[model samples]
Target: MTKNVMVLVDEQHRLDSVTAAVEACGVRVQRVMRGMRTIVGAVSDDAAIERVQQMDGVASVREEKSFAVPPNHRDIPQ
Candidate 1:
């Protein structure tokens, strides 16, 4: 199962190196947030996330949450 993740980079390492490491771990990079020291990407499964977490420059790896609003909500006039 595929999983979306957000990776926080440590200050000691360069974002490029960390990004390369993340991509090497089989993460399909979506977008890079340089200002926030975060990388948004998707991985194949738990194993992939673990691999990313173990990388030297990675500070934290967390699952991304998605929220959506129903188009036909009873509270709103349809």
Candidate 2:
């Protein structure tokens, strides 16, 4: 099974170091949202997520999972 991890990091520090580490672990980093200073990546093991968070300048880490929403939701409507 694949694990999806989201990390909230410190923008002051360039994510290059963390990125390099994650890449070295053979995980695919899909997107890095600059605005939120967050990164989205996928790994085969949850331990990879822990390693990513342990990298310098990481504020927090969260796992992605299933969620439910109202079918007729009108919040943030376009």
Candidate 3:
């Protein structure tokens, strides 16, 4: 299963090198936030996610969470 994740680059490291390393680990990088040292990306499976987590320049890897709003019904609780 594919997983969406938020990756934070370590302050001591360069984003470019880390990004290349992450892709080598199987992350399909979708976006790069140089200012924040964050990268939003996806991996093919849990193993790939694990690989990304163990990389040298990665400060953190958090799976993306999804939430949905309540249906359009007056009876629903607020």
Candidate 4:
């Protein structure tokens, strides 16, 4: 199953290297927070998640939890 995850990188790691590693795992990078050293994306499966976690500069990987809200309740109308 596919899952959204937040990838945290080591401070010493270069963002380009980390991004390349994530892409190599076949995961799609949604957003890159350079200052925060965090990458958010969706992995193809559990194996992909493991692969990303084991990459050279990866510090940790955590699943991203999302919640559904009615359109009317949203901060910005759709």
Off by over 4 Å in 3: 67-78
Candidate 1 structure quality by residue, lDDT tens digits, 10-76:
9999999999989999899999999999999898888889899889999999899988766997888
* Candidate 4 weakest lDDT stretch, 10 residues: 69-78
In candidate 4, what are the lDDT values of residues 1-78, reduced to their tens digit? 788889988988898888888988977899999999989999868888888878899999878987885667557765
lDDT of 3 by residue, 1-78 (tens): 888988999999999999999888888999999999999999878888788889998899989889888887899964
**Which pairs of residues collide in model 3?**
none
Worst 10 residues of 1 by lDDT: 69-78
The candidate that wins on lDDT is 1
Q: How many pairs in model 1 have backbone atoms within 3 A of each other, for residues 3 or more apart or on separate chains, i.e. clashes?
A: 0
Q: Is candidate 2 or candidate 4 better by lDDT?
A: 4
lDDT of 2 by residue, 1-78 (tens): 888877777766777676666666656789988778777888888777777767787788778768766566677443
TM match of model 2 to true structure: 0.71
- Off-target runs (Cα >4 Å) in candidate 4 are 66-78
Q: TM-score for every candidate vs. truth?
A: 0.81, 0.71, 0.81, 0.78
Winner on TM-score between 3 and 4 is 3
